[model samples]
Target: MGIQYFSQVLIFGSFIGLLGWTITNQVGRTQLQVKSREDWLLDGTGLTIQGILIPLLQATLVYWLYQYLLPIQQGYLKLPLILAFVISFVVIDYLYYWNHRLLHTKLLWKVHQVHHTVTQMDVLGTSRNTLWTSLLIVYLWIHTLFLYLLADPTGYLLGVSLTSTLDLWRHSRLIIPANTKLYQFLSPWLILPQDHAWHHCCKIHNYNYGANLKIWDKLHGTYYKSKNMPSIIGIPSSLNLFQKLFFPFS
Candidate 1:
């Protein structure tokens, strides 16, 4: 398991590194780049902790759960592996939609605000989060449980990896204009940078909480659509990178 996790990190790290560079050059909303180089360094640090270390912690927790709480190695659920994967994917997305919305509330908002201080869109920025962000996330626990319960089905693993990888595009400077036919066709089901930017680019009334899908937002009332990009990004913040990293608990 340790080796597997390491491999996953190595591959994901490489992919994200290259993707960030590409998108930064191609479509990186230059108008929104308001942070300093030091801040960008901090953003990198946040991603390392959130995207890499947090997943390690999650795997450790899942391992413990698998070892004791869930003793069935061959999977108790008799459903097909693909079906289980699809079901878990949708369920996890729905769970994230609510959790993300909750994070924007008054009390919980501070913890999540660390990521919102970036003031710009960068692919690597997707993973820039305080430690508490993923620690309290519902899917971290629920998906881990599902991984063990479903006997680590191939489809489940694939779905998770693919969607997680694709999540990078949402945070990237990349944009598929809403006016395009393809964008219109997928608007109901998928979330692109434009839909997601509304959340980070605004101080209030942000929309589109679903991570990989916009179904929840479409079903609910949080979905926002706009062809024009945000003029200004990020909320006003006085905390330095270090303070932001350990804030609320610092």
Candidate 2:
């Protein structure tokens, strides 16, 4: 949480649409609007609390975990830049895939449900989880831990930036033609907006669990490929902010 981190967030938020994916498949995009200005405020408040504050507070615990339980001497090993970059990307993506899959399980779905409460996918939707749930996100904790121990700042930047870019793009209303060369090139390899939308789809929610790559889903037999849109968006068992924050115990 230094100036560099904020700088990257600012840059990533601005110009996320530079890739021109937001306008594809217009029919599939679901537009959501707030009924009042206060609704927007509430949304912003929730995002800040869960996405920023809680994570910042929990980082102290992560530091302690690193210092005591997971300390490794690999930082001095000085991995090659190219090797570190590729390994970090692969490692994070693989871990994220399984972790995302875990979120869909019956036991874990309650903790992860806040993210699916919104009917529409927007960039802000990325931070829709509750404070406690956000703190426990497998990728946020594990990925940072890996970079802390094994990767230099430069290698970590590439891995984090690439994933961040993919994440922001995944939440957009964009669509890539499944039959086009670009879609084929990126599909089952990179996460396409349509692929992610299916994950949010109520009926087909069990499929497309990969965060960055379709490889894991395919390997685990959860991969689904089709031009169809989901029957509906948003989980049926959605929770309000209070329930989201203190859910199951609320």
Provide the overall lDDT of each model, using Cα atoms, as 2-decimal numbers. Answer: 0.71, 0.65
lDDT of 1 at 162: 56
Best by lDDT: 1
Residue-wise lDDT of candidate 1 within 57-163, one digit each (tens)?
76796658666865756366656867876865777778888888888889888888887886776676777776566777886787676666674456666667656
Q: Write model 2 residue lDDT over 115-143, tens digit each, in one string.
A: 77756666556566655666556655765
Kindly report which residue stretches of model 1 are placed more than 4 angstroms away from their true locations once superposed.
1-14, 17-35, 72-74
For TM-score, the strongest prediction is: 1
Model 2 residue pairs with clashes: none
Candidate 1 pairs with clashing backbones:
none
